[model samples]
Target: MSTGGGAHAAGLIRLLQSADFARAFTLAALGTGFASLLIGRTAGSVTLVTIVIALDVVGAAILFARRDELTLLRFAPTSLLAFLAWTLASTFWSFDRASTLRGWFELLAWGLLAIVIAHVRDTLQTVRALGDVMRWMLAISLGVEILSGILLDIPFPFLGVAGDIAFGGPIQGIFGTRNMLGFVAVMALITFTIEWLSQSISLRLSIFSLTLAALLAVLSASPTVLVIAVAVGAATLALALVRRSAPEHRRTTHTAIGAVVATVLIVCWFLRHLIIRLLDAASDFSIRADLWNEILDWVRPRPVQGWGWHGPWLRGDDASAPYPLNVINFTLDDRHASALNSFFDVLIQVGWGGLLLFGGMSVVAVVRSWLVAGERRSIVHAWTPLMLVALLVDSMFESFTLTGLGWMMLVVCAVRAGQSRSWRERIRDLAEGAPGGHGSGSSQDPLSGAR
Candidate 1:
């Protein structure tokens, strides 16, 4: 039985590697996106995502064999791996050890999928994969909303959506919430904008994508999404201006940026309430403040290591058990509140030690990716780093640092941005792209099947 299973697995992998099955990458990529973003957790969906992730692991393993052993470390950041290790280690101390173990596997599966995306020979290819996956996701999501609100003339109760089918829809589509739709739309805007700037896709295609993204942004009516869109625009404009600056004027450019940042921070600090008002945020932001206070109170005792990555604590009414850190009834299937801040989320789950590690990971990913973008001189590469920046910014409101699509995207960006290749390796990549070179090997640019 074991031999037969192994043989079947090998045969499947070989099929994926074959030229005729080149579209296999697209199918796998779309599955990863849908499993993480479009579909919610159900027994059937869970089984599907698990199988898709398993297949993705096989594909990743095949691609991993092509790169130099040393370069493989670039695919997994030290902080990220450490965080995962720590999270797993916490199971030893956690009251709900079984739950912690399950959560760890779930999180690691997403990380593995990201590593697969990072297998690309260049950041441009990585971005291309992202664009392809998102194009389908956003397009289908919009279609679902239209179907629910317009043709059906009712909410998609199954999807947990409620709203009219009008352009400014309250519709949640397949994402189950307007804010989630808004978040995806903003990301789509970023992807499409970069595709336009890099000339990676045709003008018509880019315009169409932009139109869909903009329309969704308006319809979703998510304050956080709109804020993120503005931030993305600001970041893009800033990158463009810096890109156009004379090489010798970099020092001056840095100084100007610092001043601008300082001014913006000061203005935001004084007008914090006004900012919240503009976004139509709830006065208490749906109990986030209350939850944050509870978390902080509980975290005071174990400032260093805290409750051992405990998940949805105190599921029952037993008083002896540690109360949920977030002050919620764990028995409830739907959770409407979180720490609502990513930094706090880390601090709550992993304590101060985990917080520092995550911070280091974020810093290394951003700085390294920024440097590589400059080296490649590809606008898409430049755009790649921005994705991480945008994720970090988005994290400020929604605790998106771990699990799901945001987490996976951060992992992909980190692997691509922080790569360090020698001159010999650079020459090899150029040669590999040449007509007569070892053309299109698995180790170098295997995912360019679409291109």
Candidate 2:
């Protein structure tokens, strides 16, 4: 009976290892990633969050089972490894060991999710499946935002469930903050735009969804998100213009547009306070400046390793400092003081090495995605460059990395969507093990594989 039971168990494992099961697993991971954001801080720990965590585990298992079949990791840069090494090294000297450890753990989880997404999704069908999951996820969030806005008693509408309705409050559909909801909305907008452009679905439906997503973004009222949306839209239009002039200019046009957008965004961020003051909406700018300066001062003394993970930049006595205009109406805490910019947050906690790793990974991912898209010429390739531009633009003024759910979604999308290899590369992969520079199949020549 024991031997029979063992055989049954093994059979079940094999069944779970099939393509259909793998697809389901991927969907589950996406769902979990989405759900985790919705649940926010109330969901408790990893052990307590059974459903979402289970999905994450299942997704990880599915990828591990088929690890040998995919070549996704070959595209990742060695700088990523260096970044992880730097993060790990900081743990030993972190001023706040607990917070640092927690951050490191979260980073590790994100890295695993990225790898799994890249590995398990190898076909266009899988890519479509992933995209579908994203669409549905965004749709659900949009629906909640609309519903909550109608029902909630808050001024912001559909937000401000937790505590005071300060600083735009929490959208609370599944995330902890309004900013998180805004990020998700931005992501949804990007996906919807891609679908609309690709003509993958009916034009009417695409337009409706895109419009709905844009409305949701407006309602979320995330200033950083608004900035990203405008920048991405402008970048897309510019690319469209350049591509119209010459057919061969498509790749060059996208690259040039991306560079221009990045440069403009970086410059704008450096003068964010001035820009906001000029616009007569200096609230967020003032708050960001206060936090930025404090974090910068905190990090200057320990440039290398940082204060070590969630390191305390502010003490209880520091809470009396003036709050940013945006959050001035609400009660401020020391924690809020240190939680300004994601880039600065990393710099203060993980040091310059961490910043380099974080920045380098993003650049590498964007470039690699562009190169792959140039070769593949598929919807994903087109979508990735646009999405990367959006993310970079958004990161300038927002702390997306610490936003939890949205960050996970971005990482998953980036890994899976950006993993598309070129046709030539695919052919080379298949030919690597063939005999006499050709496969033994009586169907086609070795060179035919390149096509």
Question: What C-alpha RMSD separates each model from the true structure?
Answer: 6.2, 6.9
* Candidate 1 local lDDT, 206-243, one digit each (tens): 89888988887788877788678777777677666766
Tens digits of per-residue lDDT, candidate 2, 1-451, equal 9999999978776765676776676676666666664443445444334664465577566655555554534433356557767877887886456655656666666556655655555434334554566567656755555545455633333233342223333344445455666666777677766676666668887777777666656656666676777777785677456535455777677778779878987998799777676645577677777767666666777898776664223323333222121132233333463455667767876788789887876776666555544444345445666677777766666666543444554464455333443333445646686433311122221111210
* Candidate of highest TM-score: 1
Evaluated against the true structure, the overall lDDT of model 1 is 0.65
Which stretches of model 2 miss by more than 4 angstroms? 1-10, 40-43, 46-53, 71-77, 122-159, 162-173, 238-274, 277-280, 311-334, 413-451
Model 1 residue runs over 4 Å out of place are 1-23, 35-38, 41-45, 67-70, 284-286, 310-323, 326-334, 420-451
Question: Which lDDT value does model 1 have at 328?
Answer: 43
TM-score of each: 0.82, 0.75
lDDT of each: 0.65, 0.57
- The TM-score measured for candidate 2 stands at 0.75
Best by lDDT: 1
The true-versus-predicted C-alpha distance at residue 200 of model 1, in Å, is 2.2
Residue 21 CA error for candidate 1 (Å)? 6.2
